[model samples]
Target: MLSVALGFAGPALAWPQSLREGLFGSRPSDGRQFAAPPIARYVSEDGDVFTLDRTQPRPLLKFDNSFEVWALTPQPAPRGDTIYKNDLGEPVLRATRLGGITIFTEQRPGGSAAALAGVGSPLRLAIMGPQALLERLAQASARASRAARRLIPFEAEATPASSALIADSAMITSEAVVRMTKRADSRHFLDRILKVRLVEGRKASAQVAQGVLEVTVAPPQGLAGRPSSDRIVQVAETFR
Candidate 1:
């Protein structure tokens, strides 16, 4: 159903309508500005739809069939085309100056061509129902707790009381917990975290202390005023 095929010359990468809400911001408040990163939806040669959003230092990759997001960085490529890579330094996407794209994969080491599917929303937090936030918080907590083999309760505090941005930040924080525990390198960090706490701010930040994972979310920064899912995981990262 959802397959990443093709070669280098025919690179295909796309984001979905769900991905248009992301706006450019920071990896962690570094104050670096990204040149106009496209926030557009695209269809691959193989017919898979993907989305791209660069509301932070890194771009976020999305697919239509699933909600899983992968963060990528734009790099200078040959002949003016740009290559997008994950933190692991793997080339995941390439784009031509004229809006053509190539997504690299094991099946298609060369590439594939992609076309603009349609216009997408400007980078912002997605308009989610309040009920969805509550459900996401509960589900993220339950899943993270199960993965950690301990209860890692997720909670949030917002200044305006009704700011959906803050609520979205909290939701992102909760999702970050899920992301953190899923990685082998970070899974052990959750062993010491008894709870994950989120609060509103102008930039996303986190600290692990006293058995608590404290995350401060930028209300109008990152993706939709909350840190992107991967940024929160990076913020909550432990050196120990």
Candidate 2:
């Protein structure tokens, strides 16, 4: 009985024949290329129309919102090791041993695209559009290049709540002003700061997690007064 409830329901064209013909080209009058299935129509208690093969291991709904990205568990590939499939039945990206995910932009809606793992790992398909992803990559690349100078505030220890602060090294392009502030702890006494300076000589502050770093191209005018919090530090204490 339990098995029957989750039975394999194969593909069925729910749309009208005329619409289908318009989209997929003319249907054969003679029963050579096409033939109607034994069951012309089906009525279930739930009115959801069924399509696509049910028996095939349906890609897990890994991420779905406005956009969709489906990832299979990490597997060996010719170049690297992980395989990612899109909504359509196609493998669109690869994750290499060198620790980066290569997105085959040609396979995707656009042509030739890829993203790194840690920079923007576990990408949320819904909120991130193609242009957004590209912009993010550019920012991450800038961050990576300046990692030595850039003071990133990762917590000294891993816990539910931790505050890591960095001063003087986060910048943002004007177009990608998607600022979101978050509280890591209840008291808010302990928090991290992200200082962002825009290209046109403007700046802003966001309270973020230890892992979150301020990403931008050019350095701002002043960094000391940006956060205005005691937790903010100018340099790596351990280096000194």
Q: How well does candidate 2 score on lDDT at residue 205?
A: 36
Going through the candidates in order, what is the number of backbone clashes in each? Answer: 30, 7
The best candidate in terms of lDDT:
1
TM-scores, all models, native as reference: 0.60, 0.20
lDDT, candidate 1, 113-228, per-residue tens: 66565444433344555565566567657766766667777776654432455555455556666667678888766566788777776665567778877767665444433445
Per-residue lDDT for 1-240 in model 2, tens only? Answer: 010011123344344344333222344566334322322222111222211111123222111111111223234577535565542335654444443333443224432322211111122112223333334434533553343334322211111111011111122211112111122231122123333321211342333344343332112222211221111221111111
Give the clashing pairs for model 2: 103-114, 105-112, 105-113, 106-112, 171-215, 171-216, 172-216
Which run of 10 residues does model 1 get worst, by summed lDDT?
Answer: 1-10
The positional error of residue 188 in candidate 2, measured at the CA in angstroms, is 58
